[model samples]
Target: MATIRERAGRWQAIIKRKGYPQQSKTFDIKKDAEKWARQEERAMDAGTWADQSAAMQTTLAEALVRYEKEVTSGKKGADTERVRITKWKRHKLAQKALGTLKASDFAGYRDARLKDGAAAATVRLELAIISNLFNVARKEWSFEGLANPIEAMRLPTSKNARNRLFLDGEEARLLQALAPAARGEDGRFGDGCANPLLRPLVQLALATAMRRGELLALRWENIRLADRVAHLTDTKNGHSRDVPLSSAAAEVLRALPRAIRGPVFPITPNAVKLGFVRAVERARKRYEAEGGKDERMLSDLHFHDLRHIAVTALAEKLPNIVELAAVSGHQDVRMLRRYYHPKAEDLARKLG
Candidate 1:
């Protein structure tokens, strides 16, 4: 049985049934209140009623916290995912209860973030984490009644892939700029760079095409100097690959003082990121001041761009996608091609 009555100028529906908990809801209209009461009662009778209590109790912030501890912490991208989760913890959406979260709420968040200047790709990644959290919350965390609000919500279009590759001579100029500070120079260095890892990091990246994470995670036990192969135990795709080191790359490895139990590079991701930024700024400023050719400073060069350059070189030499995938450790050929930005002038030479 259900009771519909006016309270505070709104209709309230309260349902009482045998073998089930009492359910109550308020609506602006009497008809809506009646409809809801009937539906809930019928669902209870049919054993299809979802207890809204759990969803109401859990919040997005709480969900993310649990997900991070129970799920994301075990993943390889745990650090990066934690950063995203933390960002969302401060978001308005995080304050909303899980039960109250609707597709409209997620849609509103997407719109707000886009207007706030977040890229489509970045927002998409954020939303993906949210969706994953909801999934794990239901299937793994025993929040089965909690609905995935984002499942049907429209997502932003994927961003155009970056094709930013190094122009000829740009790499040399950039490395030249990085060289001085990497040596041990205290003041106004032509060579004498300070950070010992900066020069070798850049050079090794160019040589092996390893990602920043992979480079930072590289160890002595993984490297065989005589065989010219570096065994990556855990790569991005969960599969290990033997990365063949070039003679130059091997020489760079030999020159580096080995750490007995620590990583080869021993640089944090933030350090590598900040160091690269500083290196680019100094390189650009010095090259322009010295009346360098082409006047194009390595303004946009990133550490990851070195991977792009390496893949492009490998694509040219590997004869086919399989061989390129082997060297690059790319699980998918399509993904591998994304980094292989070949020169237009070289392609045009085939027509000649």
Candidate 2:
């Protein structure tokens, strides 16, 4: 039998059953309180009742901390995932207990994030982290009563695929901006980037369709110049592939002074990202100074766009889809199409 009573103008349901832990819940209505008590008592009698004490006690922040230490730390993108976890800790929703969170709460979060100018992809990733955390808790952390609130909510869809390509004279301006000043015999100066590696890095990215992470991870030991191949031991997809080097790509590598640190480009991701942004700004200024009329030239460019440009250019030479997929290391032909954006005029010329 369960006890139902009114306290502080609200009804409270308390169930004290033998051979099981006691359960109590407060409800606004007496009927709701009695209804909950009956259901809980019946479930206990049927041996179908699950204790949600752990989920009810644990907050989202606490769970995220545990997930980050035990799970996210072992992942390849651990640093990135940690950053996301930290962001979640700052949100008001993080204060709520895991069991108290509902699909409506997550839906509101998605709506608020979208209103605040957060990208659909970014929100999707954030929600995915929470969803996965719930799954891990249910499967491994002995929280079988906990439900994934995100599973009931529809995730925001992303349609932000970029097709950014370098315009006429834009590449030249960017390269010039990246180039460091030449030192004379008297220690005089001339035009280029202070870091000698930046130019070659950009050149190699354009020559080969290698991702920024792939380029940064490139090692001299993996290069077989005679065979014109760069062996990648690790890739985004967890599969290794040999990237064939073009004459231009080979020349860029040959000119670079070998680093004793092992990595071909010893720069960190943040360094490359910051350096690329500064170089683009400088290029834009120089382009305008040279009477370049197009406002879009060298504007809104990203380092990752280089991979897309390289893929599109490679499509011209390797017309066969299979051969192009081999070069780009794209396991799916559909994904390859996303990167290969050929100009209509070029296609028309080829048709002629």
| Candidate that scores best on TM-score | 2
- Candidate 1 local lDDT, residue 49: 82
| lDDT of candidate 2 over 8-77, digit per residue (tens) | 9999999888888888999999999999998888888888888888999999999999999999988867
lDDT of each: 0.82, 0.88
lDDT, residue 206, candidate 1: 85
Per-candidate clashes, comma-separated: 8, 5
Candidate 1 structure quality by residue, lDDT tens digits, 1-352: 7999999999999987777678788899999999998888878878888777667888999988888998898987787788889999998889988888999998999999899998798899999999998888777777757788889899998766655688776787667766644323554534434567878998998888888888887899889888999989888888888999999999999999876566898777777777788778877777778887664457666777788888877777774678788888888888876646667897799779
TM-scores across all candidates? 0.82, 0.82
Q: Number of clashes in model 1?
A: 8
> On a 0 to 100 scale, what is the lDDT of residue 91 in model 1?
87
- Candidate 2 global Cα RMSD: 4.7
